[model samples]
Target chain A: MTAAATAAGAAPRRSARRRLALVLEPYLYTVPSVFLIALIMLVPLAVGLSYAFRDLVLLDPDSGGFVGLDNFRTLAADAAFWNALGNTVTWTVSSVVLQFGLGLVLALLLDVPFRGRGLVQALVFLPWAVPSFLSGLDWAWLFNPVVGPLPHWFVALGLMTTPDNLLSSPDHAIWGPIAANVWWGVPFFAITLLAALQSIPPDLYEAAAMDGAGAVRRFRAITLPFLAPTIAITIMLRTVWIANFADLIVVMTRGGPADSTQILSSYIFTQAFQRLDFGYASAVAAVLLVLLLAYAAVLVTLRQTFLARR
Target chain B: MRAHVLRRRLFRVLHAGLLACFLVFALFPLFWLLKVSVTPNDLLYSEGVRLWPSRITFDHYASVIAHTEFPLFFRNSAIVSSSTALLSTLVASGAGYGFSRFAFRGRAAIVGLMLVSQMFPLVMIVAPIFRLLSPLGLTDSLTGLVVVYTAFNVPFATFLMQSFFDGIPRDLEEAAMIDGAKRFQALRLVVLPLTLPGLAATLGFVFTAAWSELLFALMLNSSAAASTFPVGLLAFVSKFSVDFGQMMAAGVLALIPVCALFFVIQRYLVQGLTAGAVKG
Candidate 1:
């Protein structure tokens, strides 16, 4: 009734000026955001896209000339690009799988009635609250081979000999950041899934119990299906985050140990900022943009399907 | 009934044990941070494998503050983060409201473009951004960091704020308009009041993001005068030796503003501020 009344009363066509004002209202609210976004975001992006085609120097602006896919050609053969690409894939896959796995288990456990539940929830969520850089720094310290608690304990227990800096080893450097990423990222997955869990009706579980369904069977048949959409969205978001994250790498390894831990983002940083290769960096960025666009398309499709059923 | 009771008790015990183990795993790092920050430098290696240190001191904290450039870094970080948060929230709120309410030309494209902006790695844009800012004399300035952070943050922040605005009902504005209010006045009186929680959340989110951002800060600013806390922390690790005590102390101090900010605005952070603002 209120919707109908508001719709009829504010139709605005009663006066031409009022109608025009109504038409302009939405645009006015949007103008400031649109202007800032255009200037700071859109224009820079256009500039970047153009750079992909031009030979550009970071220090010398006047050096840029239309190169016509030269940057792309260079990146295609670059050994570092392939290596970084491989590392990025490995990093994203491992981190996402472990994070979701741990998060789902934690969420399931937290879903059950238990003592100190609130305290546990708060404690688990603490890592998420800490800044990512600080969390990375904290882990960097804990994984320090010289005086870190973890390595020290391992040495004393005869687990490993002497000082072994995880970040200094090619095989383990990436894992240090991966561990920190999981520590921080698990909470997001847990919270989102927990919210979804709370919304699942208890009657379904009761019905399952009455049918003598075991706990694993009930979870598989009842819980998993309902949680699929949330889980999918969580994975998509985390994949994008993990793929692009550079802070942890910068803090823990700085893409070091012979660039073993270098992912695409860090590689791009090195190319652009460290090497001052503006044109190449833009091309690399454009590649990342393409990958992300594909990811976003899948996400949109998933959201549509989920919403359609709802 | 007795058998059922026994099974239920067993399940409870299992749940308790699992959660307890996970909690310890999750919290061990934070506990270790505190433990190491207080452990004296000499005992750091000497007290190997011990759960608790035999002794603790505030000397690290005292040295970090009094002897280092941490205070300047803290001040610079404060200025940059707070400004970015305030500006981005204000900008995002306005944009979000427009997106939520208006069906203007190119609106969808604009939003899609913003999403595209978010996908590219910041590393890709760093050199171009630096080149773009250098001519404007923004390099090595705190204002440069603010501009960069605000640009990077505004899109996501706008999306977040738009979700909030979408939750607010259009009826409130219509009713106010019916009672003889201009559109801006109606928005100011009716809509803005309800957007407080959203505004607070956006501010807190962006502030924390800018506070810890390092790449742009490192690339854009070179001098200690303009360096933020993250960059300042890097200064503690010289070529010859890393002062773990001072570095950890600085890391601990950086948590203060973030913790205090979260403590103050956590009500908005946790609350589903959109509830009751819209109808299903």
Candidate 2:
């Protein structure tokens, strides 16, 4: 039928209908995805926003009534919320920078020819497949002074004066989750950067090497420029992602020995799960969503201006 | 010439040494997990910092499998992950084919919307999803988790599928159409088999993602019947507070399916990833 319609010797109306169907076909294919995403994601996002304006408790029968802005009002004065906001910034920056740095080094290393490269690549990237929750628990065990080696090693290296669970120290507790976050997250960046590295033409390096460029000089001139766009987008997306990643923090410290490791996402989890305070949790989640959107917008605009300048 | 050769030799050795250090750093925590899981309860603390256990035992694994509800959790997770993988892959491959084949109106709008979906803090929707699911008899159900995970996974999976579809020649499908096969028939007969690697990659990604999701599993399923491996492992953390061995054993089991899936899909993922990067 399609061939007949396209042959230009067939009925004009039939060909028009065929063209119309071709136009509609893409929408027909996309309908399921759009419908599912709208139903499961957007509708909930709208409902969740509405939830922030009302009193919503899971167990309380009398809590459905609107108490507009009350959750936000309480959040303003909540000390833990404020601390969590601060800790969130620290956590996001530290984890992103460390993960990117280590991942870049790994990607660069793997970009070259080496013996057993496949095996080394697989083993190095294995952490990315470990469930985040398990990664959290595993690291928590490693930091335990009793059954694990890390703290004892730390003491021996003089990083600590005595063997104590670093996860239990309020002054330094946030580092526990950050360490696990960096370790688990490094593989994600490495894989992405490696792919981006592979896409760069080899002659860019070869030509530079022929001109007597040293390793550091070649990286600064050839590699860094090529990786910049990927680095920007990856860093932006990962910042937002790591900010919302509360699992490691929640599992390792449960928001801590004294709520010291509490970040905004974990606080939201605690409220929604433990206290059943859906309204406050949704409110905090709303704040996080808004902040992330702002961050993403800024990044997009910056990249736009950057490309325009170039 | 001698100095340059010496420097080059040193560089090679340094590269190997640094790579080895990273390998150990990456594997050490997991190595400890396995070591702890196999260590006898008596030696768990006594050989606390040992590089290896004095003796090994599978008692922790046996207890976790025989006594605890981990087997049930594993079954639930398998059901959820597999179904999620199949459902998401089917829907996404369709969307991907559409994106790849058609230059239709509203394509940009649809792609933009998909990107927007990727931006939000998904935790914001946890409570609302719980509310939405419970009324429909979906809470504490494998189908509920499947539905939730399928939606979460479809956007990225669709992009992956689209890239795979893009890699295929349009002429192949056009030839099928000219040969009297319907477009759907052409996809099924000609294009589908060729995209098997991409489909495998999508399934593996979705399966691993659903396997590891914990928050919704914890919130939506209060009953033991619907608990996933992560949820069940957390329960053991509290129940067997003193038995690190058992907890690690359960943790190791949770890692198995995902790790296996990872190995299967990593190569396809490399290809899909490059295509995606180049396209978008």
Candidate 3:
């Protein structure tokens, strides 16, 4: 009787240990990633946010002093910052709109079953494989009149009075990078939208067609509603991405020709990378982060409200 | 009926035409790159706008390969990108497995943090990362690029892997565990084999991202010895702005690995993203 009671007591203790291990197993698997992200990305992000308040300059031993909004004060008065902010709006809006518009058209075209569709899809999406810097350079070379065909084509088409480098003109220089960005980013939108498009039930379209709906009518009734969610989420995410995208502009224009092509991201790059002014760059970055967060928040709330109504 | 037939025929023609336009637009720059690379220096400016050069030569390719720092840059890029891919995939698989198998405390919060990480402006951390890594003797090092790229890639890769794991049924591993196996062993033996494709897609995706990365590589590694291809190419552009043929040759070389990987993995990427869309 005494041995039996001892055995029963030990059974619960063993099971409890097993239960604890099971609970901890997930953490064991997940903790390394959490630890690394926190250490490498999150910690640096925090430090960067703090750098906005301090005077931090690269290679300057004496510059790490608490500045307490001094960077912000300077940024407020800075004409270049304001210009970049304006240009950022132009850049993000134009790029997102153009990419979405073209991508939707491409997706719609690809949706219809046709011969050699696979080959066509592969060919059209090829530009996305080009690296951003290379895309920028490629487009830049195209705009150069000396060796590129674009200027000659433009002149022949009467779109330009001369075979001049479009990249050198301050008034129209932003378009150079924008064109590159559109080329590189269109495939991303097309792929996502195409997936969403494919997911819609073919029966819905068939049923609508049988009810005497035309192509436009079917698209309006069935396709638009199904695509609305994906479109919203994609455009939101892409806006944030394009706004932060500096590589194309940096490589293509270097924010030159009177800083006309300098969006907020490139401006931040310029301040940090070229000027080595870490504090000011972080300040600009902090502002950009806040703006992006606000934009995202507004989008989320709009989505929530829209969903609730639906 | 006759009008309907003609309208359909017209639509088909228009569709084909539009597709052709898109194909040309998509390929023109790459074709131009190739064209310039093969065009002799004398012919580059003279027949710049020609549909095809009268004569083509591989002299630019030979020179870029034999004469420039491109080989070194390519090596550095290959090392950094591959290391980032391998390490990120490994870490992500663990987290992905965790997210897929267990619903535990803090899971939602962790997922949320990762999503937020995707949105945060990476440019913000450039300076602080520089500061942070400099002290650790990682600045101007290939190891530093690998670490940063791995961390940047892990969040997206984890989500990708989790989606893949979600597609797989839990019963496979459960059966293994029931047959006298530990959880990790089940993962290693059963789930890992199934997840090979997921691992490969993640590897390719991360590799492309790292290979294309220019900013951090440019900022962190200033020395030519440590420079990745993008930085080295940009430097070459500024230093030898007139050498269009050789520069285009180098550019073509940079395009090879990424374009090859992209064609292979793009379908998987699309599937992954679609799965993510439905779930999200």
Candidate 4:
């Protein structure tokens, strides 16, 4: 019964209670998660933000005083910071481009009907399950001059002058981590893209086939458009995520061979963990947060404008 | 007509070849890890880039099991991940169900809050989380890791569970309710059984995430006993002078559980994921 009936005194109070409960059900259902996230994530996030403006070193008891923007000032002039910013761009772009391109190819391949497709899908997607840190280490091992075949293959293919470890080369060192990242992350793109592909109506293809469209022509006319939105969003999300991702870099090179691979995130890690510079690390983190938010805003606006134009 | 047939045949060959390349690219490093893990010590250097070792031995695996702190780390990882998965799933399913079924007050606000959690650099929160947990004596314990991981995972897990819940018809519970069962009771009796695969998918995803987490595991747990597999594996890497075979064996061992969980859950992943806010 409606609240009107309850006011008319025809409905029992038990049914009224049930109605009230129904009204509150969503709150009751979601409150636990909201509470937990508030306590664990938001509280700590507040504390972390507080650290950005304060002088808080872990080992130093006397270092809890407020130091407004001092670390940010230091950051402005820091050469390592500048280098890391440049490297973050290079790393994020290369990793996303490689992973996305390769993943799309893989996804399209899987979308085709074939024998053992299920098993093959599972196998290809297996790399996504291998822990990021392990993939980093595994790829690092694969590039080791002594044991791995990659460097040997590189030499044989005439791509390298010697069978030397790629991790030690300052110029090409970033690619090592990027390659590993591509290996680990391609499955993520493939899975998402394949999901998108599966959702595409099959009869569209059948209809196009009836119209005498070639494979490439039909794909260009249909598949690409269907995948565009998925591609755009995935690229944006993965770009931000890859920029923040530092585990592979840290594990493989520790920002390596003279900080060649020190993206902003890994730089933050090194400052915080290795040097115990929490305040500075948090400063770097705050800057990164602002940068990411700005990036996200731009991407969202671009997507909006693009949609409007379409 | 014969030219068209030959072109199709050529394209088929090309596709097969490209797929083979992808398969090798995906699987080769894993195969190398396994090969190294099994190669006998004498043949390790002698093998030098060979696909298969002349001699195979389980000594590395045996040694890793018998003579190391890996078992303790493995156990700790399992405890933390499983606890995180269970707790996150329980809490997230409730939230997801609400989101899926209702359009109530503060729904948008709550969703925006969860999305905010996904936005920030989580490293920013590490120090603060450490400070918050340390005073409560939660640091260096598996429980600490579980709580943190559960919170970290809840956002994605909620979205995932919401998708799964969204897929299920609400009429199942409504029909039960019409027969005099409470809504919660109907949910338990009628709806819950249907969501088992969805629940399993969420559980396995969260488990895999928690198991592989390195940074928080490193920061929160100072003790060897509390360190998860990632931390232990990282520590093992520093001992490069020590047997390479044993290290790879530990890496292989670490890869096993998550891979198995993922293999089981992979089918559900796309469907469950696509149903929710996967676009964002």
What i-RMS does each candidate reach, in Å?
Answer: 3.4, 1.5, 1.8, 1.9
Q: What is the lDDT of residue A208 in candidate 3?
A: 92
The DockQ of predicted model 1 stands at 0.42
TM-score of each: 0.87, 0.94, 0.94, 0.94
Residue B63 miss distance in model 4 (angstroms): 0.9
* Per-residue lDDT of candidate 4, residues A209-308 (tens digit): 9999998999999988777777877787788889888899999999988999899999998888888888998898888878877887787788777667
| TM-score values for chain B across all models | 0.89, 0.94, 0.92, 0.92
Question: RMSD for each model, in Å, please?
Answer: 5.1, 3.0, 2.3, 3.0
DockQ value for model 2: 0.65
Better of 2 and 3 by DockQ: 2
Kindly give the stretch of ten consecutive residues in candidate 3 chain B with the minimal lDDT sum: B271-280
Candidate 2, residue A67: lDDT? 97
Each model's lDDT comes to 0.79, 0.89, 0.89, 0.89
lDDT of 3 by residue, A46-137 (tens): 99889899999989999999999999999999999999999999999999999999999898898889998877887788788888999999
The DockQ-based CAPRI class assigned to model 1 is acceptable
- lDDT of each residue in B114-159, candidate 1, tens digit only: 7766666766666567778899999999999998888888887887
Give the poorly placed runs of model 1, Cα more than 4 Å off.
A1-14, A59-63, A111-119, A153-163, A198-226, A302-310, B102-105, B166-195, B238-241, B263-267, B273-280
Residue pairs in clash, model 1: none
The list of candidate 3 runs beyond 4 A from truth reads A1-10, A59-62, B169-194
- Candidate 4 Cα errors over 4 Å, as ranges: A1-12, A305-310, B170-181, B240-242, B274-280
**Ranking 1 against 4 by DockQ, winner:** 4
lDDT of 3 by residue, B1-280 (tens): 9999999999999999888888888999999999999999998888989978999999999999999989999999999989999999999999998998899999998986776676666888977788789999999999999999998999989988987788778999999999999988999999998877778889988998899999899889988889999998999999999999998999999999988887777767656555555444
Determine the C-alpha RMSD for candidate 1 after optimal superposition of all C-alphas: 5.1
